[model samples]
Target: MITLDSASNNNTAMEELEELFIEELMDLLNGIPELTVIFSADESAAELKEYAEALQSDPVGKSRQIVAACRASGQRRADVKQIIVDGNRKFLWQPGGTLRVVQLLRDCETRWSSTYLMSDRLLELYPAVQCFLNHPQQTQIAHLLFTTPQYQLLHDIQTILAVPHAAQELLSAEKTPTLSAALPAFEILLESWIDLQTKLPMLSHYIGVGIVKIQEYAAKGRKTRAYALAMSIVILCGVTFIS
Candidate 1:
């Protein structure tokens, strides 16, 4: 027989949900398992080190400045909006149309994938963006043009982040993921990240820092696995003694 429990950490809403609904199901079944598989790292803390939030800070801030400049004028904003729309239309109708043009995606604090998608889309729209900013009508927003360093930063951020984004996609499948999958996936992810540093010399610093963070999390995972194994052995010994 398998027992499943829906317990939560200290979040107030989750606590309330667990008390109200999850507890009812737990009572109906029996109780939760002593050890539950924890998938994924604590994102709130781990994200700062693993992802491009740090790398993209300047670019995102610069992008926001562009938004602010465009919003300052109705005509400027309209022109910018029209440019994006035209790009989308061109994307669909152009003879050698690559793919559908994705809109400017906002990065969410909670979702790392949003950062990747946002950077990717921004890179795709770079040429159109350059034209719009350089246009005489867009003189006010000219100062907001993305710089060489900023473009390079976004490119590096997207490449390094793609690995974790892919891993997250694999782990978050609708089907139940096994605990064994985490370690191997992480190992491969770690190696890929390390290899990226060598390939992109400019990105070496961020990738190096990220590798250290991943190692820390991997160490914690190993300890948690060892502790669980020890406890399981102890429980088995107790069961044999009782028998």
Candidate 2:
């Protein structure tokens, strides 16, 4: 069994290894006729990470601008953190304080979930971010402040990315990683993106693209016996538990 990421080099390596296993090793070890090599890729991680990178490069929308603004804001995390904390403190001492202070999150280039987290935190602290940037002393980064429409676009981007982000997190469970979870996660992501296409017309193009990418990966995953067997075992366990 071989597991790899969806890189071109890895794909090439898998193909060559499979050929070796079939043409050379199979004959050499003819006694082990039932033996076979299982080649699997981390489709969930690949899809989410590639989708984020592709979205950032898309020319059709303000996603790139929104990400850039968030990245710029993160560059001044200390100042933003102080602003949010002070604002929260003001409400804390008030009669009916309901505000919770949230620090601005910075996205890592390699992780799609971080991008979602940063965008989510930014949207959550929108008012505080605006106030911080609007201050006279903060004029340097004032230009990085998001406009009303840009904020809406940012929200849309966040919404679109949420499905895959959640799927990635679920599949990345530290204690109970299971292949049975992959197909369902892909299905959920496909359903969410298709639904988003209808709900967010402005992002229909990107969402449509995402739907196709997920479908492609899902189809590939369905061909794997390990995935099928894992899902079957999960179903059996569920039935037993219910009974």
Candidate 3:
């Protein structure tokens, strides 16, 4: 359900924007280059007006200041990037397993990824955080959140359950019992991270709860359908035997 929109205002607007991908399970959206800001001009209008007036007076200075900040401390290409997502404005570290994928998500946006949890102010500042977890490559990682309804998370955890054991075999000093499998251990780490994040109440919501209930109903329906099919098969077999 997430769609990536273009943030470009003109021919020169696209740089990293071209890196966006719309893979099977991912949705991303871009915003206008500069005008997406949600300004609160209510009581603060006087000060806000003053600030804009200053910017208007010295637009070149404002540009230079931003450029200076980036050049002075540019870490955009690093494996780990910090970004504000929604209202929480959480500091970020790439999940160790998928740093490259993290970078892609960190710079992207998705409408369906639920940035509503983020405040407008935070979103305004870092519009790319919402889709960070939804990139196709990180889809499996995102499912690691217990609040998610999808089974891919558990499936992914199961996939990596033997990583520690594998690591043990690789170690020299008497590779004892392989420690543990690497994959599931990684899943455990992911689970812990996500669980800790949700506990922060500010980011907690009923979405996962609702998804779980939906899954339960779907499971029940499948079971009921299977039972009916089995009954129909038995009846047909008996009738054929009589013939």
Considering every candidate listed, which one attains the maximal lDDT?
A: 2
Tens-place lDDT digits, model 2, residues 1-243: 122222233323222322332343224234443332211145543333333343333312233343455446445666666766787777742334533555656555445355457667667776766776688977775776655544655566667767766776677677663577787778877888888999986456656756776788888999999887876787777732221
Model 1 lDDT tens row, 130-193: 7678998777668877666557755665677678767666656664433434556678788998
Lowest-sum lDDT 10-residue window in model 3: 16-25
Show how many residue pairs clash in every candidate, following the order shown: 0, 0, 24
- Candidate 3: tens digits of C-alpha lDDT, residues 87-127: 23442323322222222212124321112212221223322
Backbone clashes in model 2, listed as residue pairs: none
How displaced is residue 16 in candidate 1, in Å? Answer: 32
Task: Tell me the TM-score of each prediction against the true structure.
Answer: 0.57, 0.61, 0.18
The candidate 2 region of ten consecutive residues with least summed lDDT is 1-10
Off by over 4 Å in 1: 1-57, 67-99, 110-112, 225-243
> Global CA lDDT of candidate 3, please?
0.29
Cα error, residue 209 of model 1, in Å, equals: 2.0
Q: In terms of TM-score, which candidate is stronger, 2 or 3? A: 2
**lDDT comparing candidate 2 with the true structure:** 0.57
